[model samples]
Target chain A: GIQVEQSPPDLILQEGANSTLRCNFSDSVNNLQWFHQNPWGQLINLFYIPSGTKQNGRLSATTVATERYSLLYISSSQTTDSGVYFCAVNGFSGGYNKLIFGAGTRLAVHP
Target chain B: EPEVTQTPSHQVTQMGQEVILRCVPISNHLYFYWYRQILGQKVEFLVSFYNNEISEKSEIFDDQFSVERPDGSNFTLKIRSTKLEDSAMYFCASRTRRTSNEKLFFGSGTQLSVL
Candidate 1:
């Protein structure tokens, strides 16, 4: 099984601030996805980048497959962005068949 | 857009009682999964079902746990006998079978509290 590790277990930011969250995996991943768990406990798929960079609204993500790492960037953050961000990965082996999640990075955006 | 939906947003049950969590996955998705998260803990995978049978499952999904795709739209996770530790947020997810990769659509989740 591949291990997914996310950094900065907790973060607090004021509105308009920016932050970057990182995830590292122990093995090669066939696919990688990022999710935001809002205050209401709804997991929204933010990014599905197996490799390369992508952006949506105020959020962007980049996955360096060769390095086994990925990053999620929140730009000019708003209070609505407050929630837990999760990075999940599926490796090239049997472990890659199912997505395994990280411990999550909890973000609190204060107005 | 179409999304996964779960019923009984919150549930409180007694230990040792049978409880079934229901979900309606995206109409076109082929892979279904059940996951749980204890408060302040990492989300854990329980089981994965495909083709009307379980394809893989974690150790946490033991004898007491079972999954069923009883119909075209409904997927269910049944816990035969619950335990106090079972109290957590349960999430249901589904993904379509794309040739390369697919993103999973997750339901809002069920907050189950076992007493």
Candidate 2:
């Protein structure tokens, strides 16, 4: 089993500020995803980046698979962005891949 | 977009009682999974189902827990005897492809509270 670690266990940012969240896995992964668990407890898919960089609106993510690390960037943050951000990876297991989640980074974007 | 749907958004059950949580995964999805998140804890994987059978399960899934795709469209998780620790937000997820790179779509979740 692969161990997933997320940094900055807790973060508080003012609206319009920028922040970066990092995730590091112990082993190589074939798939990785970023999720936002909103205040309502719905896990919203942010990005499924196995490698390279991808941008979606004010949110973007970069995964350096060789380095076994991924970074999620949030720019011009808003109050709506307040929630727990999670990073999950699909590491090989029993001839298949299982999604393993990391302890989320709780972000509070105050206006 | 198609989404996974879960029933009884919140449930309250007495300890030792049998409880069943239901979900309807995306119609085209071939892989289905159940994950749980205890309050203030990380989301944990419980089981994954494909080809109408379980493909992989975590230690969290024990003899008291079981999963079934009773019908072509409905997926369910059953607990023979619920315990106080069983209370958590249970999520149902689905993915269209069996490959590793495919993204997963998760249902809102069922908040089960065992007393």
Candidate 3:
């Protein structure tokens, strides 16, 4: 089983600031995804980057497959960005995909 | 964009009681999965279903749990006898294909409280 660890378990930022969260996996992965869990418990998909880099609005992510690590960047953060950000990866064991998630980085943006 | 939909946004059940959580995945998706997140914990995979059978399941998915497609559109997870530890946010997810590039979509999740 692959292990996924996220850094800066807790983060606090002022609105309009920028932040970066990191995720390190123990093994090579075939798929990786980033999600933002809102206060209402909705897991909103942010990016599906198994490798390389991708950006979506104020959020962007980059995964270095060879290094087995990924980074999530939140630019010009807003108060609404307060929540838990998770990074999940699929190692494709037994010929199927099962996403293993990191504990997540809890972010709080204050006005 | 199509998404996975789960019913009974919240459920409360007494220990030892039977509980069923239902989901309607994106119409054309072929792979379906159930994952649970205990409060303050990372989301954990429970099971994966394809072709009307379970393809893989984690240790957390034991004899007490079962999954059924039941029909073309609905996927259900049944806990034969719920326990206090069973309380958590259960999420249903689906993907259009088996390819690693296919993105997986998740439902809002059902909050289950076992007393």
Best by lDDT: 3
Write down the C-alpha DockQ for each prediction: 0.55, 0.69, 0.73
Cα error, residue B110 of model 3, in Å, equals 0.1
C-alpha TM-score for every candidate? 0.95, 0.96, 0.97
RMSD of 3: 1.1
Between candidates 2 and 3, the one scoring higher on DockQ is 3
Candidate 2 lDDT (Cα, 0 to 1): 0.94
Give the RMSD in angstroms, all C-alphas superposed, for model 2: 1.1
Sort every candidate by TM-score, greatest first: 3, 2, 1
Q: Given candidate 3, what's the lDDT at residue B25?
A: 97
Residue-level lDDT of model 1, residues A7-107, one tens digit each, is: 89999999999999999999988889999998887788899999999999999999999999999999999999999999998877773267889999999
lDDT of 1 by residue, B31-110 (tens): 89999999888888898888898988999999999999997889999999999999999999888873326676789999
> In terms of DockQ, which candidate is strongest?
3
Q: How do the residues B4-90 of candidate 2 rate in per-residue lDDT, one tens digit apiece?
A: 999989999999999999999999898999999999999999999999888989899999999999989999999999999999999
Flag the better candidate by TM-score, 1 or 2: 2
Stretches of candidate 1 exceeding 4 Å from the true structure: B98-100
